[model samples]
Target: MEGRNLASINYNILDKSQQKLTIAGRLDMENISSLWPEIFKLIKKNKPKVLLLDASGVDYCDGAGIGLFLKLKEKQKENKGSLQIENLKPEFNQLMELFEPGQLSKPEQIPSFFKRVPEQIGKSLTISMREVYSQISFVGEVFVKFLYTLFHLGSLRWKDTFLIAEKSGANAVGITALLGFLIGVILAFQSAISMRKFGAEIYVADLVAIVLFRELGPLLTAFVLAARTGSAFAAEIGTMKINEEVDALTTMGLEPVRFLVIPRMLAAVVITPLLTMFNNLFGILGCILVMITMGFAPITLINEIQHATNLTDLFGGLAKTFVFGYLIAGIGCLCGLQTGKGASAVGDSATRAVVSSIIAIVVADGIFAVIYYFLGI
Candidate 1:
C-alpha cells in the first residue's frame, strides 16, 4: 500500500477492504477543524471494512482529539465496519481514559415525559427532606447552647454580641428608615386615593397607623436584616468554616455554637425590636408627610393614629420582631455551619442563608397570624 501524507495524517489503503490512518502533531482546537473533514471524507469514500487508527505518532492531544476518536468510531459503526486504535501515547491514553468510549458511542437514552416527572418529584422530595432534617438538627443544637448560655451568663461573649449588634442593627438604621418611610408613603397614598372617593381621606391616617404598628414595621425591618445582616453572617461563618477556623476553635475546646452563633443570635434579638421602633417612627413620619399634602394637619393625623391603635397592636408586632430576629440569625448561622467545601461554598451558603431566612420569616409570620386569630388578639 502506498501512503499519502495529508497535513498531520497519513492515509493508506491497506487492501481493497482495509484502510489505515496515522495521526500526528498536536490535535488541539487549531488543528482539529481541518483534520476532521479530511478524515471524515476518507472514511466515507473508502467505506473500509476494518479501519485502523495509528495514534503512536501523536505528540499531543486534548479534548478535541478525544471527540474525534469517538466520532470516528461512531462513523465506522454506521458503515457496518470496525475501528481499532493502536499504539497510543501513554499520556494520550491517560487523557482518553477519562471518557468511556462505549458510553459515548451509544446514543443517550431520554426518558419519557411520564418517567421524568416522577424522577423530578423524587429529587425534590429528597432535597426537601434533607433540608428539614438539617434544620431540625441545627435547631436542637442551638436550643441546647441557648440554655447553657442563659444559666452561665459569664460564658456569653458580650463583646462580640455588642459588636454584632452595632453592625447588624445600628449601621442599618439609614436604609431601614428609608424603607419604612417609602412603605408608609405608598400605603397612605394608595389608601387615600380609595378613601377620598367616599370623602374619608382623613381615615388614611388610622389605616396607616394600624397597619404599620401591627404588621409592616416589624416585617420590613426583619426583611432588611435578613437581606443585609443574615447574608453577611453566612458568608463570614462559611469562610471561617472552609478555612478551618471553626475546627481550630474545637481544637481549643471552644464550642462554635456558643462562640459564633450565640453572639449573633443575641444581637439580632436585641436589635430587631429596637429597629422596628425606628421603622414605626419613620413610617408614621412618612404618613404625616403624605397627609400634609392631602390638607390634613400633623396633629389631626397624630390624634387619629392614637385613636386607632392600642398597646396590644404595637406590642404584638414587636413580639414578632424578636422571633424574626432569632430566625434570621439562627438560620444564617445554620446555613454557614452547613457550608460544603469548595471555592463557591461561601457564596452558596450566603444565598442559602438569605433564602432560608426569608422563608422562615414568612412561615413564622403565618403561624403568628393563625395563633393571634385563635387567641383573638
Candidate 2:
C-alpha cells in the first residue's frame, strides 16, 4: 500500500471460536472507506464467536473510524458472539467515550416555581452587590486620579476640555432656549388664568422667576445634558474600549480615566451652570413676551422680575447645576469604562448612562431642597 494511504488490517484465527483483528495506520475518513469493507468481509466469512480489536497502533482517527468500530461491535453481537476493544491509546479511548450512548443521558430534575423564586432573587441580589462594589471601587480610583492631576496641571488635556465644553454648552443653546421658552409660556398661561380672577396677574412675574430660577432652570438643563452629552460620552468611550484603544493606553503607561474622563467631567462642570443661566434668561424673556401681550409694558415685567427674585435663588440653581453636571459626566464615563464586549454594549452603556445620570440628578436635587429648607436658603 502507498504510504499516503497506509491503513493495513491483519487477522489471526486463534481458534474455532476466537479471532483477532489488528488495525495499524491512520484511521481517518480516506483510509477507513477502503479498509472497513475488507475487515467486515473477513469477519462475516470467518464467523468468529469472539472478536478482539487491537487499536494500539492508530496514529490518527476521525468520526468514520469510530462508526466503523460500532458497526463491527453490532455485527459480532448478531453472530451470537462478543466484541472486545483492547490496547487503545489514551486519545482513542477518549474518542470511544464520546460515542458512548450513555455519556450525556443523565436525567435532570426540575425545580418547583416557589423554590426557584427565592433562588433567582438571591442570585440577582448577589450580582447587584457585586456591581455596586465594582462601581464604588472604580469611582474611588477616578477620584484619586483626579486629585493627583489637580496638582499636575500639565497632565490635563486642556484642548479636549474646551472642545467638550463647546459641544456640551454652546451647541446646545438653541434647544435649551426653545425648551425654556415653551416652559415659561406654559407656566404663565396656566398661572395667568387663576391670578387674573384674584386681580393678582402682575404676581405672574414672581411665580415665573421663583419657579424657573429655583428649580426648572437647573433641572431642565441637567435633563438636556444627561440626554445629549452624557450619551455621547458613553458611546465614544465604549467604542474606544471595544477597539482596544483603552488597552493600548494602559500598555503605554497612560491612565485611561485621567486621559478620557477628566476632561469631559471638567467641561460639564463649567458648562452646565452657564447653560442653566442662559435657560433662565430665555425663560424670563418668554414671560416678558407673555406679560407684554397682556397689556403690561416690557419695563413693568422686568421690574416685577427684579423685585421678586433674589441672588440666593439664582445661586441655588447654579449650585445644583454644578452637582448635576458632575453626576451626568461621571456616570457616563463610569458606564463607558465598564462596557462589556459586543456590538450592543455601546448602546447598552449609553442607555445606562442616561438613566443613571437622570436618577442621580433627581435624587441630588431632592437632597439639595431638603438642605436648603433646613439652612433657610
Model 2 C-alpha lDDT per residue in residues 153-260, reported as the tens digit of each score = 798999999999999889999999998998888889899999999999999989999999999999999999999999999999999999999999999998888889
lDDT for residue 315 in candidate 2, whole number 0-100: 99
RMSD of 2: 10.5
lDDT of 2: 0.91
| Model 1 ranges with Cα > 4 A deviation | 1-15, 18-31, 49-130
Error at 183, model 1, angstroms: 1.0
User: What CA root-mean-square deviation does each model show from the true structure?
Assistant: 5.8, 10.5
TM-score of every model versus the real structure: 0.79, 0.71
lDDT scores of the candidates, listed in order: 0.91, 0.91
